[model samples]
Structures are given as structure tokens and as C-alpha cells.
Target: MTLGFGEGRAFGYAGCNRYFSGYTLRGNRLDLGTPGSTKRYCEGEGGEVERAFLPLLAHPFILQREGEHMRLIASDGTRLEFEAAAMESRYP
Candidate 1:
């Protein structure tokens, strides 16, 4: 997945769909506003990951970065890990 955050906006491709949301961050805590995304169901794991990912974005999560990796830690300790991807590489 690819994530971009700036100017109170968060947008990215969540495995299958592209999503945009409002966000606010203070220190280590981050709150995500309701996200809207394109409605395109992907086959197999892509669709399933999208379904699980959307709701996770609706709540508060912690952002941690280590080297080239980023982790989004949910309130319940569920962690979503991401790595920086080149813009030239397309998502499946």
C-alpha cells in the first residue's frame, strides 16, 4: 500500500481501491477522518485486505517509522506495516 499525508489530507491505494480521508496528527497520536474510496472489488486477497483496511483507517492509530518502513498501530495493538514504494510501480 502507498500512503501520503499532508495538508490535513490522507490518501493512498489500499491494495485494491484508492482512498482519501482527512487526518490530524499531534505528536505520536493520529486520528483519521471518514475515508472515501473507489468502489472496485478486487479478486482474492486484494479485496479482502481492502475490506479490512478501510475500517482500520476510521479509528485512531499510531504512526511509527523506522528506516524505510512505516507502521500504523491500531488502538488494539493491531499493526499494519508499510514500506515506501516507488511511484512508477503500479499496484495490482
Candidate 2:
């Protein structure tokens, strides 16, 4: 999955679908609005991952950054890890 955040908005590939939402960051706490996604249905694991990932955005998160790597930690402590995509392949 690839995510991009800028100007208080978030957009990313959620395994099967592309998702977009508004987000706010205040220190370590971050809040994301309900994500909107394309209506494509994916089968098997892709579908499962999309289902699971979208809801995680409903809760508050803690952002952890280390060099080019980042992790979004849910309130209950679930960690979603990501790395900066290469410049030539930034959008996915």
C-alpha cells in the first residue's frame, strides 16, 4: 500500500481500492475522517485487507517516524508500517 499526506488530506491504495480522507495532526495524535474509496470489489486476501484497513482509520492514531519509515499506531496499539516510496514510483 502507498499513502500520501499533504494539505490536511490523505490518499492511498487500500490493497484493492484507492481511498481518500481528510486528516489532522496535533503533535503525536492524529485523527482521520471517514475514508472514501472506489467501489471496486476485490477477492480473497485483497478484499480482507481492504476491509480491515479502512476501519482502522476511524480511531485515533499515534504517528511514529524514523528516517524514511513511518508507523501509525492505533489507540489499541495496532501498528501500520510504511516506507517512503521511491520518487519515480511514489503513487501506487
Candidate 3:
């Protein structure tokens, strides 16, 4: 999975599909609006991950960052960790 933030929006490739949503961040609290994604069918692990991951966006999460590592902590204490990807010029 990959995530990027810019201009009040959060977008990423969510294992099986690309997703985007508006976001508001104040201090360590991050709130994501209803997300929108492409309708694509995927099987196996990607599909399973998508199912488990997307719903987490519905609730606010606490963001933690240390160097190149970042983590999103859900209200239920589920922690999603991510490492910074190399910046590419492909995205605008």
C-alpha cells in the first residue's frame, strides 16, 4: 500500500485499488472524509487487505512519525505502519 498527502487530500494505491479522500489534520489527529475508489475486482491477498484496510479510514486516527517511518493509530488501537517511499516525479 502507498499513501501520499497534498493539498488537503490523501490518495493512495490501497492494495487492490486506488483511493482518495479529503483530510484534515490538526496536531497528531487525522480525520479522513468518505473515500472514493475505482470499482475493480481483485482476488487473494490484495482483496483481503482492501477489505480490512479501507474501513479504517472512516474513523479518525492518531498519526505518529519518526524519521522515515509513520504510523496511524486507530481508536481501537490498531496500528498501521508505513515507511517513506522514494519520491518520484511521476505524480503531479
Over 22-48, each residue of candidate 3 has an lDDT whose tens digit, in order, gives 899999999998788887998999999
Which candidate number has the best TM-score? 3
- The local distance difference test score of each candidate is 0.81, 0.84, 0.85
Q: Point out where model 1 deviates above 4 Å.
A: 88-92
**Position 78, candidate 2: lDDT:** 97
Give the range of the ten consecutive residues with the poorest summed lDDT in model 3.
83-92
Report the lDDT tens digits of candidate 1 across residue range 3-88.
Answer: 77755678888889888888988998888898888888698898888888888888898989999888989889999888876653
Residue pairs that clash (backbone atoms under 3 angstroms), model 1: none
Q: Model 3 residue 34 lDDT?
A: 78
Q: What is the TM-score of each candidate against the true structure?
A: 0.83, 0.88, 0.90
Our model 3 lands, by Cα RMSD against the true structure, at: 2.1
Clashing pairs in 2: none
What lDDT does candidate 1 reach at residue 4? 76
Model 2 CA lDDT for position 59: 89
- Candidate 2 lDDT, 1-92, residue by residue in tens: 76788656788888899888889999988898989988897999989999999999888899999999999999788999999885322322
lDDT of 1: 0.81
Give the C-alpha lDDT of model 3.
Answer: 0.85
Candidate maximizing lDDT: 3
